[model samples]
Target: MASDAPADSVPALPDPVSRARLVDAVRFDRDGLVACIAQQHDTGEVLMMAWMNRTALEETLATGRVTYWSRSRAALWRKGETSGQVQRLIDLRLDCDGDTLLALVDQTGVACHTGRRSCFYRAMRGDALVALTEPEADPAELYGR
Candidate 1:
């Protein structure tokens, strides 16, 4: 996996031919977005899930960094732009239906906005919701508002 860096630190953009083939295979939703799940490439641990528009998907494929479409902000969101938890893309996979994406990445830090290693920190232990892990970093510091 490549080194993790800030959103601004994009490596050389990928070859346009390959990138175009990938972007064309995706079946975006009505909102022009696709569900993308980030997972640790080495550990196979699921990290987080986010939405990606064509721009974000193109950027990520070209730069080798995970990028997402922020629905609330209605803008492209480069991972680790505000928080220092960048995810460097090692590989990306499209579902059979091309409606979902799986990003194999090298995670720099916590993946959750709540400062946990993964967004899936909660579980239904029996009939009750439970938190399986503790926050590894402070939420306040993670966002660095």
Candidate 2:
């Protein structure tokens, strides 16, 4: 006898919660933003860290494109909007306390505005900061300077 479930039927994905629900789940900072850390899904490399407001988190979930709140610009920043380094969301994970978020993404190009693969290219060695990796592409070429 065949099973009742259809072969082509995909498992029901959890429905997205409302903005109010999300707000309740996450504990935002005094500025009403949470720290979102982006990591390369396949390589397990940390790409960068950014801040996200309620709207940015909602938009990211709805659009599958990483959106961040730019503290410097005081506005929503869509990844790859200016540069070609887009981040496609693979998964989103909330921390135990729900104060932080981890975004697993497929990075298209360099994740750093400095044209590096990751923003964390500096390491502490012998009480001195050491550069881990060099820029893959020139910032001028990537940003059209």
| Model 2 stretches with alpha carbons more than 4 Å out | 1-23
Question: Which residue pairs in candidate 2 collide?
Answer: none
Query: Could you give candidate 1's per-residue lDDT for residues 1-145 as a string of tens digits?
Result: 2335443433333578888898999999999999999999999899999999999999898877788999999999988878868888888889999999998888888889989999998989999999999999998987765
**Best-performing candidate as measured by lDDT:** 1
| TM match of model 1 to true structure | 0.89
Backbone clash pairs for candidate 1 read none
lDDT for position 121 in model 2? 97
Cα displacement (Å) at residue 51, model 2: 0.4
Q: Could you tell me how far off, in angstroms, the CA of residue 49 lies in candidate 1 after the best superposition?
A: 0.9
Counted clashes in each candidate structure: 0, 0
